[model samples]
Target: MGFTSAWSISAHEDAFITELVPCLGPLIEAEETEPGARERWERWQTSGVDDDLVHLVTGGGHVQRLYRGLTDDDPFCVMDDVWGQEGVEERLFFSAFSKDWAVRGLFQAVGPARAALLPGWCGNFVLTSAEVRDTLPRIEEALSCGPLEKADADRRSGLDYLPDEESVLDGPLRMWRLAAQARIGLCGVSLVLD
Candidate 1:
């Protein structure tokens, strides 16, 4: 009933879009030609996302590749409420931990402006292969600033917290790995909020 994150590695954005747009054609035509079709589908929709669409998308390349061969042991996994931004949570009225602060810290280490690019948990976005390669150095610099180090400092500063903090802190690292993999394959990283 909560959020489930899904991502993919694509040769390019248009490749996935080419796969997606056609899938939506029938839905659009149905809405126009069939009376009550829009209402019927809307009944199953939440926040403008059709239930059927999510089911279809989660099965395709744009969603499947990232999920392939993954297991419960993977820390930064799909299908969890571990993400989202403050604006989205407020507009949708879902009170959830977005990991915004945690992720933002990583980007903030790069520059405050880059932090703004952090997308909503359920937001669809892409990072091209070129982007992945280009951003590595800055991302590495950000990593050095200590999402983990900050956790340790917080503890030392008398702010007691859970010992499982490292797992949560690993989001950026996992993200880095994902991006790197995308780069290696000459693909782009696609986050599909389903």
Candidate 2:
């Protein structure tokens, strides 16, 4: 596994997300060409009626921190925390999901000092080397489970629909995450620690 340098990125103000739609239009159209693609996307738009998903990702590991703040002030700037917004941190095996938007994230331990500063840090796990090995199969199982097999079930299931290509993989710095894909319009950060 390889480790990449840590960095931060932010969503736009107002929407709390950078509108990558225009840039992502081509990719969305491509997904439309995949098997049952359009139906899957529509289903995703409606899935997750009541559950706030606590997805997990475990691979080597990467430390990525994101925050929601005044886009006007930071304007695409990245920060260390949720920036007064709600978020969570935990140790996890690398994982990704396909519900509202294909999401791939990581889990890492927060230092005593930084944990005090970051929000969304309850009930998260700290990963161990052995735990990492144990978690890989689980992560693979989660990703290989298949696309949203039922209508509206995806929404109710608390995850966006994902195609096989969206599987998370080991990246630089032992980091495992979903490669940037079209269906993943909603973006969030997963922070992991060594």
Candidate 3:
């Protein structure tokens, strides 16, 4: 599995499905849904609605990394090990919850508004833009303190999975890249389950 990201143009997921995903289209030559689709596509292309999302797309696959040596252990918990911050493992989401619910939960669960959500990180959590912004500094601080590999290695022998090579794909670095891109994209990283 991997991850993809975008700028948070909306509290819901409209920009992701409509704006950012379409930016991947080849120069905006809209496709035909049926026999008469091309004409409709062309009309929309020249409709003078400015494509506002082109500039927000970040280059590179930030969350695109193989799960080489990861365990079921929470990465945010690993962050806690480095940052000494508590309750992070609960704050993250990886599932397809309703946008309003997820966004509200994240906002409430991460900051001064956060409460006893009572064991979060259930069913594939996702973070919205505000949540990402709230948690990013802690990530940055944790990265500065130490590598996640160190903390993770203690739990399981993830190092054994490594080949005798130097240029291995680092999970922590990939996380940083994802967070950075999400910050710029005004969105949070969405894990792409394989």
Candidate 4:
């Protein structure tokens, strides 16, 4: 099976994990029975998570790559090893539970980048409102440049599944737009890429 990425935007991380995740099924059920619940229920259903703490930001594929490129200094250099080696993957998975492992793995994979950029490559991390604010313009520029096709071509020589360029940018653009919203509203956003 191929890798797919999903994003969750949330203001309250603790409540999201402890309270929201566990109650999603009932919430969806309750919403379904309401008069205008379909639209609301549909939003929660799309998050791919069952909870009120986080809203799923939906769009394209290769979001991990797009985010990395947008936030890193040597974006193209990291593209050479987009998925990373086995060791890096193991570390990335480990990072889910250990922040130390995440920091180490991020440095190893991308090499000497800002702490702010680590969340883009790793799972289960939060970006501050300032970080989100700073990143908005870069995300915009990356989307406008439309380099996914070339990046894909440069990263791999022969690939059977090539993603649509438009579709590729949609996810990250939407995610970042949501991040901007969260920042404007004075809330921190947590990014969960799975």
Which candidate number maximizes lDDT?
A: 1
Candidate 1 — worst ten consecutive residues by lDDT sum? Answer: 87-96
User: What lDDT tens digits, residue by residue, belong to model 1 across residues 1-194?
Assistant: 54433232222233433443333333323333444434433442433333433332222333232323233563332222112323222112111122222222232233333333333121223444455566566545544445677666344223222455433224343454555665531122223333
Candidate with the larger TM-score of 2 and 4:
4
The backbone clash count of each candidate, in order, is 0, 24, 9, 1
Q: How do the candidates rank by TM-score, highest first?
A: 1, 4, 3, 2
Candidate 1 vs. true structure, TM-score = 0.32
Clashes of 3: 9
**For candidate 2, lDDT tens digit of each residue in 173-193?**
122122111111122234332
Give all candidate RMSDs, comma-separated: 14.4, 18.0, 19.4, 19.6
TM-score of each: 0.32, 0.23, 0.25, 0.28
Model 3, CA-based lDDT: 0.27
Candidate 2: list runs displaced more than 4 Å.
Answer: 1-48, 51-126, 145-194
Go through the candidates in order and give each one's C-alpha lDDT.
0.34, 0.27, 0.27, 0.33
> Could you give candidate 3's per-residue lDDT for residues 105-184 as a string of tens digits?
22222221121121111101233444545655654443332356544422331222224321112232234345455452
Best by TM-score: 1
| Global CA lDDT computed for model 1 | 0.34
Compose the digit string of candidate 4's lDDT tens values, residues 1-194: 33333222333223222332222323333333445434433543344222321122221122333334433463531222322324323212111211122222222222222222323322233345566568777556544334665454223312222344223233344555665764521121122243
